[model samples]
Target chain A: MNEPTRPLPRANELDTQEFWAATKNKELRYQQCDGCNTVVFYPRRHCTGCTSGNLTWKLSKGFGTVYTFSVVRQSYHPFFRGKVPYAVAWIELEEGPRILSNVIDVDDPLVDVQISMKVELVWEEHEEINIPLFKPVD
Target chain B: MKQRDAAIVGIHEYQSRDVEGKVSALQIKAESAARALEDAGLSWSDVDAIYDAGDGGGMNGLTIAEYFGLKPTVIDTTNVGGSSYEFHAAHAKRDIASGKANAALLTYGSTAHSNARAIGVGGAGGAGRHPADNMDVFSGMTLVANYAMVAHRHMHDYGTTSEQLAEISIATRCHAMRNPDAVRAMEDLEFLDIRETTIDDVTNSRMIADPLHLLECCMISDGGGAVVIASPEVAKNCRKTPVWVLGSGEATKYPQAGGDITASAGAYSGAQAFGEAGITPAEIDIAMIYDSFSITVMVLLEDLGFCKKGEGGAWVEGGRLRFDRPSDGPALNTDGGGLSSNHPGMRGIFLLIEAARQLRGESCSQVPDAKLAVAHGNGGMLGSRHAAGTIIMGRD
Candidate 1:
């Protein structure tokens, strides 16, 4: 039997296609409402704050802090079952948007990973997209 | 219309968790519906409005109405995760008060455990990808991890400890010991230790995710429940004492780029519920909080105004949540709650059923003179996007 792979985003979503396309070049993109100066992540069409269609895409510096995290001791997904006790967190980016990612390059996730710990972005190159991950800044 | 113009006249919880595929989800729902209507001293024809969460299939209102053979007017198929029933109650209340429907029926059923499904370990699955799923699913975010993140943040922000979170599990287990219908009491499930749980029992349990032990999580049981709401005019002639729907509110919370993970939608929904009830949380005698996880109840306790913000860790420390505990706070989970009793996928309907039971002075672990109750249901994930529904009921 073929090994199950990680869940992938559907190709060519109208709102998020640009985001995935940018990831091909290892660029992390977020949106900022041009009208209200509001930051948006996850690449939405309109501003959540003001519902403004006028938005601008900005590249992230990929420096962030751990807003919150959990050391998942159990997962049933085929791709994740073997990787027990990995850390998943919401990273508070310096550019003012939080993104969900795995905190990689940690010895022990429960002991090393913590809230407010500074981290820098790294990329996990997949066939379709370069998934953004974070590692603790030394 | 007055807030108490609509009342819950009847409620029924399907007690079996070991259906073993002998019964279908729709079958359980139809049975619960018939039993609830019988409890209300009303016939099947008395139900003019039907409300369901569509857990069985898409277009739930039409599907459920057709299955029950009802062709009435109002149909609400609000599926906001688990809190859909509370939202349904709010809509049913409005419909009944406005003369749009005299008697409204809300029903739910799930066979999660019997199907041997992984409740929280598996990430949400769908046929096609959505924009939000693309962003988060790659991280391998399981449902338990989502709530575990919230518990981690709460501990970080307020110095909350694992022992403090364990207190919630211990208290609910105490109530579970008193409930004969709790999952622990199932004779065939002899593998389960039916003894009362201690804080150590909770803390020492295997960790599913960081900051959450296995004992702190709710049981996955195959069960369902039904609720009947009617206008005051119809309530007077019901079989049982009417549990007046004094107030209700529903709201949604999501990650707004970088929202507070510790705060839940309960802050908004609970306030609207209590404000419309014209009473404070202190006036509540029983609190049937959705205990999907121990942290769920702890966070909602603070967000629902039962305690000050960031003070929930200290607040739940004692045995204060027990029905028999002598405290100023409301008795919690008098029917054993989702934590120890029964949680079949969407547990919102059980909250309403248990709250109505307490108000009728019929709970297994009854609180004396329980005149007022609050049933708060949190749907989706607390750490991610979620919905909250709050309902306050009073006995006449």
Candidate 2:
């Protein structure tokens, strides 16, 4: 089947290229500082914890808990014009570093959802990138 | 070095309007400066420094200086979001104390109304493929969504109800009812209407983001504000009574960079301000805390030590913020704040103006015998990359 079309993130940047590339294989990768053992997200070259440049990528267990969330009832983006009332949340990964993603498979996710609810990483194939998403574990 | 006293000797604001044939942003700045200088009984030559708190993206100080035909030795252009002017005021106080500048003029103006730019929300433009657009692209992040996330987290962690947040909007609307200069009364500005609002009204309002209703958001306005800060000697010679800058503090942190959404840098900045002022939170007579949204005030109250963390929702209940419950706290947002009054993008300067007026006994809803006032503003986002500028003002 053809990949569903959506706004795709660019993977040409020096810092975030690897993270985007990893998403193509359904992997959630974050950088681990060699000196401080700190995990960083949004693909950083240096450790935010210790400012160390010696960093390495590691695959996440892909499971996390909902830190906080909001149901985007209104959107200015033309892509989301008809897709109102979507739930978006910040997931606190088990390995550390929180990432923002949409929570699917739940009705009225904003009201029915609870903090610390278990969720796992998922992916949506778009024209240009494999977008990382999350869903509450059934 | 001993800290020399500095004070705000004059203040003025161009009414927020949206008339046809609106003048340039620089003209608004010039008019505000001229009026503020007149209010302070000073001429252009008296302004030894100029601080541009302009939100427009450019070299604000140079632009304003050239437009106003001033050649000050010092030109400060510090941009920290909505609270940039509070930071400017803090810096100006220090500059005057250190003899770097004798008279510093701080000015701000925005054409959000004239340009018809949606002041809040996500602003104009849609998400496009950018090599650097990060995770926000997929999530479809907007300003309302960001604050709603905080409200949701605050509710989950502390059991703070939506009703609690709504109370802030109600009280601010009540305050706005008393301010003739508020955006609500602006002619031809029908959307800026100020009317009686309740918890039910807030809860029933159209949801911009889950948990944040239309009532909870701040009113966008096009306004200009100016304040002249001077050394104690110059303040003594001014036309109006000088409102003393007792203390000021500023802090900046970014989200996705370890900033806590529920907690802001106001905790640190407020502590620094209160410590410098040698006063306690209870001693404050009035507070002009920024209210970009209802949750903004709730989080700030907790962070600024008005109440313990997680107690802000409870503290504001039962007409506490309206100064109705004598046992609760000081008068909050007496000038209606951004929620009901005017939010011209960045609202930091308005906070200073309101606080100065309260201390000067010039506010319409004047706190009885108001001696000390606190003005705090948060800029940026709920968690991601924010600035908090807190100022403590007093009448000595």
Candidate 3:
């Protein structure tokens, strides 16, 4: 039996296509509004701060601190059911935007993950997208 | 145009929590609507405005209106997840006060229990694709995890303990034990241990997500409810005591870049509502908070001004939320709430119903001489983006 693959972004996602494309090159991209100098994450056309349309893309060094995290012990999705006891967190990147990613490469997510812990990004290569994950800084 | 006062003249909650294969969502809506209208001493003819969250089907307001065989002039289908009905009640109050409509009806129903839906455990970024799915869903963010993250952050920030969160579950279960409907609902669920839960029971229950035990989570059930907000003219002729809509407010909150995860939209909506009502949290007699999770109620208690921020864990201690508590704080979830009563996908409508019930001195766990009430609903995920609706009501 084939393993159920995780869902990926559709090709028609025009707003985030560039962000995913950059992820393929092992680069994490976010937008900064030129009008208000506001940082926007998860890729958007307009600035969330000032609603400015003139936004510029910026590359992240992929280093951040864990703002918050939860260890999911159960999941109903076929793809995630097998990956139980995984850590999901909101990482506050040094560049000023927060992104939701998994705290990967941890021996035990429940006992290991801590808030405010420094972490650096790692990419999980997928068929269509390079998933950005993070690990605790040594 | 001069604004008139609006009151909730009728309210009805569908009694059962499991109606799978027995009734459709539309049928539940129609039935609840009829019962609520009848409770108001009115009929479908008196309803000129309709509000729904489209929990039934596409074009929800239209579908519900057509199914009920009504020609409502004003139709609203404002859906902000579980808090949709609170938003509906707020809009209906505005419409009635402005003379845009006379009698406004709000209804909701869902068959999640019968469908065997894993609402909290179901991970995000699945079949329902969105623009942000690729970014957030790949992290395996489940609905329960969203709220759990808030609990985790709360513990990290304020040293909130698992025992403090368990108090909310224990207090709600205490209220549920007195409610026959809640008792029946629990008995129907084979997987649940149908009895009043203790702190140990809540803390010891399986952890669905770290820091949030399974007992802290709201049960999945099939139920619906309806509310009728009418002008004072209509309210005077109604059968029940009028529960006046004193004030209402709605707001949305999300993980805006790096915003504080411990805070919720309730802070804005509650402040707006209490300011409009000319009262403070101390004046509230009953608080019908949406207990989607134990953490939900704890954070909302702080945001709603029942207690100071970071003090909710301490404020909820010592059985303060219990109905029989000697302290003067508001009695919480006197009808068992979503934690113990019935939570069919959307629980906002029931929040309104229970508040109205307590104001009328008809609650299963009645708070004596209850004169004021506040129903605050939190929809969507607390960890991610969500909406909050707060309605302040009074006994007339």
Against the hidden true structure, what lDDT does model 1 obtain? 0.88
Predicted candidate 1 versus true structure: per-residue lDDT over B60-125, tens digit per residue: 778789999999799998999899999999999989888899999999988887798897898635
For all predictions in the order shown, the interface RMSD in Å is 1.8, 3.1, 1.6
| Candidate that scores best on DockQ | 3
Model 3 regions lying over 4 Å from their true place: B1-4, B125-127
State the DockQ of every prediction: 0.67, 0.51, 0.72
List model 2 lDDT by residue over B1-396, tens digit each. Answer: 123379998888777555343676677777888898998999888998998864545876676787888899888888888878889889999898888999999998876776777545552243444323555666776788888889988998899998999999988887877888864433435653447588998988899987899999987677777899999999999998888888889998655534467998899899988888888899887888889999999999999899999999889987788844434678889887787777767888888888888778788777777888889989888645689999888887
Which segments of candidate 2 are over 4 A away from where they belong? A1-6, B1-4, B123-133, B183-187, B256-259, B323-327
Tell me each candidate's TM-score. 0.97, 0.93, 0.98
Shares of reference contacts reproduced by the candidates, in order, are: 0.67, 0.56, 0.73
Query: What's the ranking of the predictions by lDDT, best on top?
Result: 3, 1, 2
Candidate 3 lDDT over B265-380, as tens digits, reads: 99999999898888899988899999999999999999999998999999998789988872559988989988888999889998899999999989989888888899999998
Give the higher-TM-score candidate: 2 or 3: 3
